[model samples]
Target: MPIAPKHLKFDDGSVTIIGVDCATQSSKVGLALGSMSKGLLTIDKAMKVGKSGSIANVVSSWIRENSTTKTLIAMDSPLGWPIKLGEELIGHTAGSSLSTEAHQMFRRRTDFFIKEQANKQSLDVGADRIARTAHAALRLIDEIKEQVGMSIPLAWNSELRHPISVIEVYPAVTLKSCRLLSATSYKKESNGAREQIVDGLSEFMTLPEADKQSIIDDDDILDAVACVLAGSHFINNESVGPATTEDSALAEKEGWIWARMPR
Candidate 1:
C-alpha cells in the first residue's frame, strides 16, 4: 500500500531475463533464461532444477555469469515471509495474542491486490496453504545468498536498478492476463490438460512451431516461460505492483508480487 516507484528502464538489447517456479519437488522447479532481440524472445537456456544439480548453485551461477549484463529474475515463490506469518512462525510476542480475524487481515497487501487483479486466489504465504513452497523458497534464498552473495529476500528491485534485479511473479495470473488459458484448467496432468496448456502458451508466446513440443510439455517450463515474460515487462518498466509508502513497514518486510503486465 505504498506509492509505486518511478519506472526503471533498461537498454532494450542488453537485458537478460530469468524466470523460475520453485516447488517442493525439485523436478517441478522450472528454470529458463531468455532475452528479447528484434522483438522476438529467444529462450537461451531451459531446464528443470533437479537436472541441473543444486537449484541454488545453478541459478546463482547463471546470474553471476551474467552479472555484467542487465538481468531481471522473475521468481514464482513468496520471496519474503508475510509480516504476520513471520511473527507467528517465530512466536514473536506481538503475534502471540493475534486472533483469527487479525491473522486474516494481516495477509500481505500485495497478495490480496494481486489476487484481485488476476481474479484468482493465491495461497496465503502466512498460512499452511503454501508452507512447503515457502520453506523450499527460503532454502533457495539461503543458497543464493551463500553462493551469489546477494540478499534476494530483502533486496529492493526498484531502488537497486542494478544489472541484476529480482521480482516475485505468479504464473497463473500471467497466463490469464495473456488470455492464453484459465489459470486452473491447464496445470493438471489429467485429460490432456497439460498438453493444452503447453500448446496454448507456445502459440501465445509465438515460439517456433518446431520447438514448441520440447518446452511446452512440462507445466513447470510453461510457468517459467511466463515468469520470463513477466521479467521482460519488468525490465521494460511495465510491471505492476510495488509498495513504497502506505504499508511501508509490511511492504518492506513482506516483499510484493509483481504480476502480469498490459499487452
Candidate 2:
C-alpha cells in the first residue's frame, strides 16, 4: 500500500482518535478512544453508551478532558444523502415522473466507489432505515459542535490540527480490507467468530486482554474498534479518497467513506 501525499505533517502521537458505531438509540451506539505512537495503536477505552447516556455528552466530555490533543472522530454512519436525490426533490410533485435512475437518485458517488474499491456496498442513505441512523449521527455531531465550540468539519486528509474533526467509516468494509471476513457470522451471538476477528486484528494493533474481551462480547464494540482502525488508516493516509475533481465536488455534498483499500 502506498502512502498518499500529505497536505500537512504532524506527530501521530499527538492525535487521539475515537471510533463511534453510531445508532438511533444511545444504548446501541459504541465508542472507543485510542492513539497511535511509533506505528503501534493503543486503545485506551471502549464501551457502549448505555440507555441513559448521550453520544454528544460523552464525546464532548472527552474533548474537554483531553484539551490539548487533536481529536479525530470516525463514525460508522452515512453523514449525507445523495446529491441527486436532494436536487430532484426540490420541485418534485407527488405524481411527477423522475428523470434520474433509481440507484443514482438513492446512492451517492462514494457508495458506488466503495462497492468498486472494497467489493462492499453501503446501505443507501436516501432509501433505507439507515437514513434514520444518518440523521441521528448528524444531529449528534451538531450537538457536540455546539457543546465544544468548534467547527468539527469532515476531514479529507490526516492534517488534523483542529480541536475536533470527523470522518465517515464502515466497519464491514474495514474488515474486508483487512481480509478478516469469515464464513462464520461474527454479528451473531457466536463468541467463536468474534474471537477469530479479534485474533486477526492483532496483526495491525495491540489490544489489551480486557479490550479484546469486551470487543468479542459485543459486535458493536468490535465495530467501534474497527472504526478506530479505519481512523488509523485515514490519519496515516492509507485510506482511499476522491479520485477526481468531479468526485471531490460530489463528496463535499454526499460525504465520503474513508476505509483502507484491500491489498
Candidate 3:
C-alpha cells in the first residue's frame, strides 16, 4: 500500500467522536464531542441509527435525518473500507489498504516495514494503528473539501471546531462487562445472562417507561455492534485497560504466533 501524503490536511470541520454499534434491528450510536474548553472527548449525544444502503444513498439519509454534519465519523469497520471511501469522497485514490486482499498485502509488508522502521528507530511496529491514524490525521490535514456521504471520517478530528468522534462498539464487550461468562452457563442458570438481548434493547430504548412485554431471542447483530463499540473504545483513549498480563503459549514449532497483541 502507498503511504499518505506528507503535507495533507485531514481536518476540515468541527469534529465529533461518534461511537456506532449496529445493534439488533437498529444501529446504536454514542457520540462524544470535544469539550470547548478541554478539547477532550465527552458524550454529548446518542441515537439508534438505521439505514437503507441502496446506492449513493447508503449513509447520507441517516446523516440528514440526524442533522450530523461538520463532524468526522469514526467507525469500527476494517480501515480498508472507509479508507477507500474517504479517498473517493475527495476524488482521489486512497493510499491506505484497499480491501481484504490489501489486508493480506499488509501481512506481507508488515515484516518489511517493521524491519525498516525498527532498524531506523527502536520503536514497536505493533503500536496502535487507530490511535496513530487519529493523531496523524489531526496533525497533518490538507484535503480539498468535497461533499461526502458515509459513516467514515472525511476530515480528521483535530480540524473541527467542536470535534465529534464516532466509534463502532461491540455487544460482546457489554455482555462480558456485564459478567456473562458463558452463554450456556447463563442459559441454564437463574441469573440474568439470558436477559442480555432484552437488557441491550432496554438500553436502546433508554429503558423506556411503561414497558410492555416484548420477546427477544438472539443478539447476533447486537453482539457484533457491541464488539465494534468495545473495539473502538479500546482504540480511543476512553478505555485504558490495566488488565493483567498472562502468557499462554501454545507455541508450536511454527512460523510465528502473537497472542493478544496489546492494544
- Score every model by TM-score: 0.77, 0.92, 0.33
Give lDDT per model, in order.
Answer: 0.67, 0.87, 0.30
Candidate 2 on 1-263: residue-level lDDT in tens? 11112323454467778899989999999888887776678787888879998888888887666655678999999999999998999989999999999999999999999999888889999986899999999999999888877778999889875657999999998888889977777899978988999899989887777677889999999999999999999988989999899999999999999999887
| Model 3 TM-score on a 0 to 1 scale | 0.33
Q: Which ranges of candidate 1 are over 4 A from the true structure? A: 1-12, 38-40, 86-97, 100-106, 149-160, 190-211, 261-263
On residues 1-263, what C-alpha lDDT tens digit does candidate 3 reach at each position? 11123423333332333333222122232222221113323333333334442211323333333343333344432222222223334553667434444332232222222233222111121233443432332222211111232223332123333322333222333344434434554333343554655465344223222221211222332333334334333333433222223111111110111011222
lDDT rank order: 2, 1, 3
RMSD of each: 6.4, 5.4, 14.3
Any residue pairs clashing in model 2, and if so which? none
Residue-level lDDT tens digits of model 1 in 6-54: 3334454566777888888777888887776555666667678565468
* Candidate 2 local Cα displacement, residue 91, angstroms: 1.0
- On the 0 to 100 scale, the lDDT of residue 151 in model 2 is 77
How far off is residue 251 in model 3, in Å? Answer: 26
RMSD of candidate 2 to the true fold?
5.4
